[model samples]
Target: MTYSASANRYDTMAYRRSGQSGLKLPAISLGLWHNFGGIDTFERGREMIRRAFDLGITHFDLANNYGPPAGSAETTFGGILKADFLPYRDEMIISTKAGYYMWPGPYGEWGSKKSLVSSLDQSLKRMGLDYVDIYYHHRPDPNTPLEETMAALDLIVRQGKALYVGLSNYSPEQTREASRILKRLGTPCLIHQPQYSMLARGPEAGLLDVLDEEGIGSIVFSPLAKGILTDRYLNGIAPDSRAAGPSAFLNPDELTEETLDKVRALNAMAGERGQKLSQMALAWVLRGGRVTSALIGASRVSQIDDAVEALRGLEFTSEELARIEAILA
Candidate 1:
């Protein structure tokens, strides 16, 4: 069947400016980090993408080393783009990152100009796109000179391979330095992708402040703490859960009794607010306007629906915020 986007897609999801840049991303963007891989069912992954667009999720985030086999997610997404999203390219924001361990040997990863440029070329080929909306350095490379990495990003922009550049997993100091270098090169750092959630408050300590000071928007990943903040684990881990998988990032041991108790309390609070635990978790991340988007990974179409519902109860009073803090404490 032909996929026609919903007419009211633009009416529901909120769009926030990417820093002071011209780009305005949907408040809830879809991330192809987990489920959209070669090992996963192609049809199911395709369905999630279609459903996300119908719900006004215009931004799709990806990375070079996303899939289990690495780069397979981009291949999957490329086929879908050629099939479904090609016509609406102008309406969507697609981003992919380099850095991290992509391949073996020295040049396969990190912040070298050769690695960054070559990785993006491969990504563009796999995704079947001439250019990506935002290209990111997947992480900061301590050994590589910041000037080289930032210059490589600026060169990609100048060469028309990417519209804007971003940084991910960078510390506050690293971000400030990278932003300074990019700005000097006539390409300001547009956005930062950080691991931020109620459970993971590392960014809150200082990363968010640097972004505000530098005018860089943030789209937080793992807003649900790898599904811990969701109801998926409320009754204990299912066999098919990520925690139960062999290569799972979320280990079963992490689900200690104390953690579960906190989760249950948070779930109760969410129930009082007429929301599911997952919905409230997402809303909590976007409560303050500091975060431009909550980048969510969904295994099924229903998960996407739950995430969209989060927008309805995004507001949190001081009391609710304090209550959440106490629970975290």
Candidate 2:
């Protein structure tokens, strides 16, 4: 059977501008950080992709080292894109990143022009695309010059390997400096990917302010704290849950009673708003529009549905905000 997108796909989901730039991203973008890998079920991943697109999720985020073996996520995504999403290519925003260890050699990783350029070439090949909508330096290379990394990103845009450039996991000062360099290079930074949630508020300290000042947008990842903010663990971790899996990204130790308590309080509050805790978490990060999008990782199709439903209740009352702050505090 042929797959056709929902006729009303754009009717519900909201789009936000990427900083002062003309580009806008879906408020609920999908990230291929976990499920769309070689080790996962191809059909299941394909279904999620199809459902996400049907729900107005126009942005799909990927990275060079996203898979268990690294690079497999892009391969899987490429296959799916070729099979089902080719007709909608122009309507989608495909983004990927580098800056992690991909191979044994020193040149295989980091922020050098060589590493970035080579990694992106490999990424483009894996995704089967001539150029990504956005390419990011996944992290700041402590040993490499900021100018080198930003210039490499600019080169990617110039070479048409990427339409826009961005940064991820960069600190306030680092982002400000890199933004200046990219501006001088005549390619302004498009967006920033940060790990942000009620559980992880590191960006609130300064990163968001820098992005606001620089007129850059942010698409926050792990907005549910790797499912901690969801109902998945309200009772206990299931055998299929990431917490019970071999992956160290989320472990049993992370679901401490203290953390669960906060989650429970927040979950109750979400109920008051007729939302799941996960939906409220996504909305909270996007509350003031300081954050442009919330990048969600869905292991199942229903999860994608739940995430899109979050946009309906994005606005929160002052009392709701105060109660949330009190609970988190």
Candidate 3:
């Protein structure tokens, strides 16, 4: 069956500008970090993508090292793009990153000019994209010269490979330095993606402030703390859940009784506000408008639905915010 996007897609969804750039990403964007790999069901990922676009989610985030086997997520996304989204291509914001451990040996990863350039070339090939809307250095390289890394990004933009550049997992200082270098190269940084959720407040210490200073928008990943912020583990880790998987980042040990207590309190508050824990968490991250988007990962189409439904009640009273802080405290 041919996939026709919903006519009402843009009517109900929210879009926020990516920093000082003209690009406005959906307040809720989809991240292909998990569950869209070659090992996963292709039909499942396709349905999720279709539903997301129908719900006005225009930004799709990916990277070369996203899949379990690495690079397969882009391949899966490319297959879907070619099949269902080619006509709507101009309406989407597709971003991919390099800098993680991809292949082996020196040129396979990190921030070297050779590494960054070669990685983006391979990423473009995998995703079947002539150019991504935003390209990022997945992480800062300790040894590589900052100039060389930023220069590689500028070169890619000049070559028409990526429209804008970004950074992920970079510290406040690193971001400032990288932004300065990129600006000097004539391509300013557009966005920064950091791991921030109610459970992970490390960004609050300083990263968000730096992004504001740099005029860089942020789309935070793991805003749900790898599903902990969701109701998926309120009782216990289900067999099908990520926590139970061997490669899972959220192991059962991390589910301390202390943490579950906080989860239960938060869940109760969310109930009082007529939203699910996941929905409230999404709203919490988007609160104050400092963050541009909440990058969510969904294994099912309904998860995506719940995320968009969160926008319906994004506001939080000062009392509610204070109570939340007390609970986390």
Q: How accurate locally, in lDDT, is each candidate?
A: 0.94, 0.92, 0.93
For residues 210-276, what per-residue lDDT tens digits would candidate 1 score against the true structure? 9999999999999999999999998899888767764466877878999999999999999999999
Kindly list the per-residue Cα lDDT of model 2 for residues 1-329, writing each as its tens digit: 58899999999889999999999999999999887777788999999999999999999999999976699999999999999999999999999999999988888888999999999999999999999999999999999989889889998899999999999999999999999999999999999999999999999899999999999999999999999999999987998886776555587788899889999999999998999999999999999889999999998999999999898898999999999999989
lDDT of 3: 0.93
The candidate with the higher lDDT, 1 or 2, is: 1
Scored by Cα lDDT, where does model 1 land? 0.94
User: In candidate 2, where is summed lDDT lowest over 10 consecutive residues?
Assistant: 242-251
TM-score of each: 0.98, 0.98, 0.98
Q: Give the clashing pairs for model 1.
A: none
* Location of the lowest summed lDDT over 10 successive residues in candidate 3: 242-251
RMSD of each: 0.9, 0.9, 0.9
Which residue segments of model 3 deviate by more than 4 Å?
none
Q: How well does candidate 2 match the true structure, expressed as C-alpha RMSD?
A: 0.9
